[model samples]
Target: MRIKVSLYARRGEVLDYNHCYELAREIRRAIKTVDPEILSDEASRLYTFSRIMVKNRSFELCRDGMKLLTSQLYFFFSSLSKNICDSLIDGFVELRRLNAGGISFEVSKIEVIKESKITGNEKLVTLSPINFRDRSCEDADFEEKFTEKLTKELIRRYTIIYGSNFDGDVRFKVLKCKSVAIRVGGKKYRAHLMVFNAHGSKKLIEIGYKSGFGTMTDCGFGMVKKAKRI
Candidate 1:
């Protein structure tokens, strides 16, 4: 399931560039408040079953800093749990104040992506930027390492969610990767916006879609959506 949230801020609100981490924390807080069990130590050890993405964000340059315009936030879940979904929606709506990178905003709208609207084919997928490591690796070795790491992560998350290990042929080749720097929780990390060709089961692909592809997904790092073509 996918959930989209609309946020609005007053004019002249300054927001830092790397605010996804903070935004993710707020979302988690809302989920935890509604049901603390979701964040228990045991659960923490398990694979993250959700992913977050920011959309329609706009920033303005100012002498002081960059100012941000209101935008939409997306959340993807692996399971269709009513309790989890309801808690997220209710908690977020009740707690209207949200702060991202120290900038405050109001939650204006919350909408669920129904089955009809959820479009994606799991077999062939395209991931947005996936922050796999904190520092850069050899350009030649990056693709191999990325594919291995992602395959392992998918297996882990698949076991946690489905109660079985996936033993399928997982293969990928990097179509393109653009080097970039990402700041989250006041720390900077080297990352990439990579397009890859993945050959895997539908379940594994779905896991990547819902739970994110690489590391730091919970901090909003590796969220992915279906791409018709790379």
Candidate 2:
């Protein structure tokens, strides 16, 4: 079966879509410019995907609606000033805040994600190493020795990719699946393995960290499971 991929905008049969689509495009651009730092730092904001999605569909007639919706959404960063970077950070923080506050779904399990790819420098790292010590017919003249060297390169390359954000055309899978969470100060935290309903596409994510202490992932969802929402 062939898959059809078309970017969706508020076009086609939708009238008065220019404003909505323009807003939507801008929001997406802003998010793309902000999420990397926001995700890595694990911050919090006073926003929600529903709100963002709504604003992205803003209109002149619905101007009041947009403002009302956004007003409830706080800039969950350190301050209320709006910048592209700040907006993304705030959005990221807000998403986590809801998830931690029992304002979202109750995820009972997750699968740790893994990604591995051999390209560029990593490919060089996976090559046959230059024999140095003794160029004899015993130590460096066997297929096993070559295989071992290749394996070592593969390990090093994977290690670097896992830690750094240098993923180039790399794909992911469930890596040694587990059902546990992590903690930093005194709260519980875990990354979400987000799977969209469309095609079951997934990405390992750690959205929430902590609450009342300015977005963090240290606090687990178990603490905010409705029974503790106050």
Candidate 3:
């Protein structure tokens, strides 16, 4: 559990800064409460007005440690998001410094990430409705049926993918899908699932389906290609 934090705050203007190592110590203490089992690498970083450059460094840390931070805090363990944790640490440290209240990590950036990508395993698989049935609507929806079996199969595949890789991952902390650009049969495919996939890469779909929600419009067979594992 290694996190390197750097902050830029005004001194008398709006800045109540403290020693760099001391700030790191406060962060270390706060993290211990968050997770005692953390294998922390470094300490808190309070970069005062003279050291505003630390912001860039903090951003890089956000990226490097994002995976671990998210896995331990957010989606997997339901602990907290990086922003939230940073905010908490900031507040805790600030309050102690001024014996006052209110402080924040205005912004942070994460640089570089590590993950496993299996290119050979990326293959196109087709699923279809085994049984044809009349499509029905849910009152608000227009009805047109193709194959219920196909829907079930898609759902099953979705469950297999999402249920397996997503909800069950103990090492994952955060799972945010930003945007996705997909095409089926040389046509652009726009949907929520695609959007999510666009946000984060392999993190959202390690060994599972991209979208847990079986999309009704997710038609046609397509190839599943993956990047080489790093």
Candidate 4:
């Protein structure tokens, strides 16, 4: 299931680019309010059960801070189960405030764009800048190790969510990876904007679409979306 939400800030309000974590927090808060049990377990909390995206209307830099000028924001949520999707939809409706950086907005509208299962042998995935790290050994080959780590992480997440072992070989090739910086909790971290081709089980790929890729998905990192062929 996939849902698109349109949000409108209260009059005279603005937002910042670094509000990704704040937006994710509001999403989780809303989901927990509707169905607290969804996050009761460690596995559930870690499971990439849903993926999100926040689209700003426009952006600007100012002395006060970076400002998002447009009143409207769009959010996309994707998952396998319609029930989970429905819960999120209801949660947004019941939400009192969509606050980010102390700024609040109202849910102007919500729409379900895709509710059915997504199936495809190959997919083009674009990842929101990912923080790929190797804390064990700083001397290791970063790119090679990062690729291996991400592959394992995806398989592990898929197994946990589906409750079935996916033995199929999951293959990924980074078509593009460029260094980028992201801010969270007032600290900046080096990350990468990656575009890749994934060839494997369609089900597994779809799971990544909803759950996110790499790590810190809940905090708005590693968000994945299908890319169109040019």
The per-model lDDT (C-alpha) reads: 0.61, 0.23, 0.26, 0.64
TM-score: model 3 vs. ground truth: 0.18
Q: Which ten residues in a row have the lowest lDDT in candidate 1?
A: 42-51
Better of 3 and 4 by lDDT: 4
lDDT of 4 by residue, 10-80 (tens): 43454555666777778778777877888675455552322222354365666544465566666666555
Ranking by lDDT: 4, 1, 3, 2
Error of 3 at 46 (Å): 20
**Pick by lDDT: which candidate is best?**
4
Runs of candidate 4 exceeding 4 Å displacement = 10-14, 46-57, 62-66, 115-127, 134-143, 186-189
Per-model TM against the reference? 0.78, 0.16, 0.18, 0.78
lDDT of 2: 0.23
> Candidate 2, which segments miss by more than 4 Å at Cα?
1-29, 45-47, 51-85, 88-230
For residues 53-103, what per-residue lDDT tens digits would candidate 1 score against the true structure? 345545566654466543544444333345566677888888976787556
How many steric overlaps does candidate 4 have? 3
Model 4 TM-score is 0.78
lDDT of 1: 0.61
